[model samples]
Target: MPRRVAMILALLLCSGCSSELRNIELQRVAKDWSLVIRASQIIPVYPLTEDLQPGDTFLVQRPIDKQHELYDERGFLPLENLIHRVNPRGYQAFYENSLGLGGDAQPIPKRWLTNQQPWTQAPIASFPTYSFSVRSGSGFSLALPVQGVPIGLSLLGSDAAQGTITIADARTYGVDTVSLAKDVEDWAAQQRGFLRNYASTGAHPNYLRVVSRVYLAGRLNVSLQSSDSSGATASGGAPKPVELVTTAGGPGPQDASLEAYKSNLAKLNELIEKSLEKTPTGSGQALLPGGTVKVVAASARAISLVETFSRPLVVGYLGFDMLIGPGGTLGPPIPTYAVLTAQLEPHPATVALELLDTAGLRHTYEVLTKLGRRGDTRAADLVKQLDGLGTLVPRQYPCNMFHFGDAAGPLSIQHPAGTALPDQKGFVRITLYLGKLQSSIDDLERAQADKSLKIATFDTRDAAVDAYLAGELAASRTALRDMYRSLQAHGDLLAQAQEHATQATRKLLLE
Candidate 1:
């Protein structure tokens, strides 16, 4: 095993040194279904397909927000400059990596890519501001330049012919590797003998880390299908076909698209809600427009629904993010695993506003919680501003009904039983924890409902919201506590996974 690790490192480390390399593939990584270089040989011949010299308006093909179609920008990666050339078509010609959906289903034209527009008008520079932690590769692209590096450990030969992707979620989302070099030093301390030798740890992780930022941040496989009736597929799936990969990815998609599921989820939710709110519909299905929606039978508080589109609406198979390592083979992807876990931390000032906007209430909550904790005796004039500090208005939209990507697996055969989600649900307890959280939510709602009658000053529940700022401010502490505990748990899980991988690899070698 040690010898093999060394061999892999030696082959990749010889940057200017030539060693025979097998057929290699280049890939583009992003969140949604974007473009990628399919399996191909990575030949280093100049001017492969197009003469896209640096600054020659080369559509390197990636995304970025602010008039950019998908917040992806690939110009920073100068493949043309790096290698003289090889087969240029694969590099220059980007193909639909996803099972074509809402967007286009063709190879993005050079013009289309060069003139990509943002989802909204005006460059939303606000996005690029946030510094990312290594929870998943969120701001990894930004993190790369510091190291002069999706960290391409994300694309191209970051895999060689090496197509391997387990999402490499190292579980440790705590330590921010803003100065990933420092992160390497720190990680070096924790690593065992063979890997500790950063001097030869496969060039200390290659560039795929960049492409992964583009292709995968977390989780897998979101399939969209509808069913006005059953025969959606020949399999005649189990009761609730769409089980949720409730782990890995973000807290699911948060936008208008989710509202489409609400009505259908409502049909099922009503059944559960109606049965005194503790009911299960005996694995019921709601025949709604465009599809047959069903709730995987579970207790009322822990609801997950799936909508099978009437027709098989597969935009594209995720195809795959193949990363062939040295010697043109496959195994648990090494080197990059550490790279994936560690992320560069962004400036708080940069991210605080953005996080507060689309992502987290934690940023806003932090200020209030701090004030509440310190119990600062400020000058009297500021008391009014302090009082309303706790009224955090979360992005209000679908209060319920979420689409947890798609059930990940060999077509998660019918969730007639709440069967599949992801191979590894973060912390194992995240799903269970949701139930406890729901209980807390239920308790809060009940308490608020009971107290509704006493407050007559303001019609909306308990007086004007300003009246509860102090109380809300105090609540931030609890909210922060939950977020902290959750993050900590994920960190611990990552450690365990790392150790487990080591042991398993050793076992495999022995066998």
Candidate 2:
């Protein structure tokens, strides 16, 4: 295994540093997805450039607001720059390396190194401002240079195939080649390892961490060109020569389209309320009110009712397993599973305002539910403001339905047996009958086919005599051999499968 890993690494290195690399150009791929890169150093200035204060909060990627969107002018830092690329381990190393300047280096503030913040709160910036004076230092200033040497390569592809890299300027008291090389090499190794693993798993190798998709494809060109302005474009315009190996994976979609699912989920909320308050027909499972319900259908018809009717029903959770036949026929409709575990309840704070005003209670509940369901905390203040209006108003209602996402697996249950709704009974019975008959027919067909083959084969002792018996003898011997081999193979496979099952069971039990 070690040898194989080494061989793989060697091959990767060869490809990474081949003579073909000289022509490879530094290119930037445009993507809707964001990329983050982190920095390896922070140099302090005698006086801060923008604002030099004692303690002013600075963060990247503040909490998302109610609309499932970032607050205005606020965004998660793109993975494009070094500051966003560095990981925690990298940060620790950078800090330690920077501090290694001994007595010559200024000490970093302790608070900046701590992870003491809420999950929703952003990480504190490496650089912060203080409003007041310090004991020895009245004010200190620092600025991230707009021109600093880039220590990393950006993978690019296709039409956006070529681009240039430039250094961002900042104070350089803390910059060192050794420190930068170590950080950049470590980051490059990480990216390469990840790409290799992704390739081995049949995934697109160019998919960056967090982006979950490839921004570029094929070979890239890298070169160096100088801009007319020496100070502004000296290091950059001339693209540094480098090579990158990218891989592609099978086209796979996101786990689920959250946006599309959310709309249908909202409609189901009303249906859930209606079902909970009343009794269902036969199954006695509390079903949402005023929607057409039907039994499992055989084949494609089953897939349809599930995909279509699911929108009207407000079960806490639902899974629509669609089976398409040879030519896209919907097969074997199964409700799989549907249940109402938690409904989105109105925030008491938001509802309280409605009681005081009465006119907007319904609208307030609706809006608050929408905001809460999307992980938007921006609504918190609005909800709190409403609650403060009066003590007489109710503060909570059933609106935040978290159970919808929490449900696991397909909802597999066929219930409310027999007939209940007389008006709809005939059609329900017919659909049920067809489904049952189709399933039965398929089963019978399989059994008959099995029996037919069994009868056609039997043990034959004769060889030349078996040759005289010819085709029948050959078939008999072949069947027996196949059966014996199958039994032996099954035992080995079963043993291996049992071992895996045992380990999984232990993990679950221990956890």
**How many steric overlaps does candidate 1 have?**
66
Candidate 2 global CA lDDT score: 0.23
In model 1, the runs with Cα more than 4 Å from the true position are: 1-178, 189-232, 235-265, 268-511
Mind giving the per-residue lDDT tens digits that candidate 2 earns over 469-506? Answer: 33322332333223222322333332332233345446
Best by lDDT: 1
**Candidate number achieving the greatest TM-score relative to the actual structure:** 1
TM-score of each: 0.16, 0.15
Cα RMSDs, all models: 30.5, 36.4
* Tens-place lDDT digits, model 1, residues 1-511: 3343333234333322122211110112222112221111111111112222111111121211221322223211233322111111222222223322112343222232333431111111110111122211223222121110111121111221111121111110111112222223222222223222211122222111211111111111111112111111111111121212122235557532455455445554444233222223468544322233244322212222333322221111111111212211111112222222222211112111112111122222333334434553331212233233322212221122112123221111121113233333222223233333333333333334455333222445445533452343234324433433333333333233333334544655799
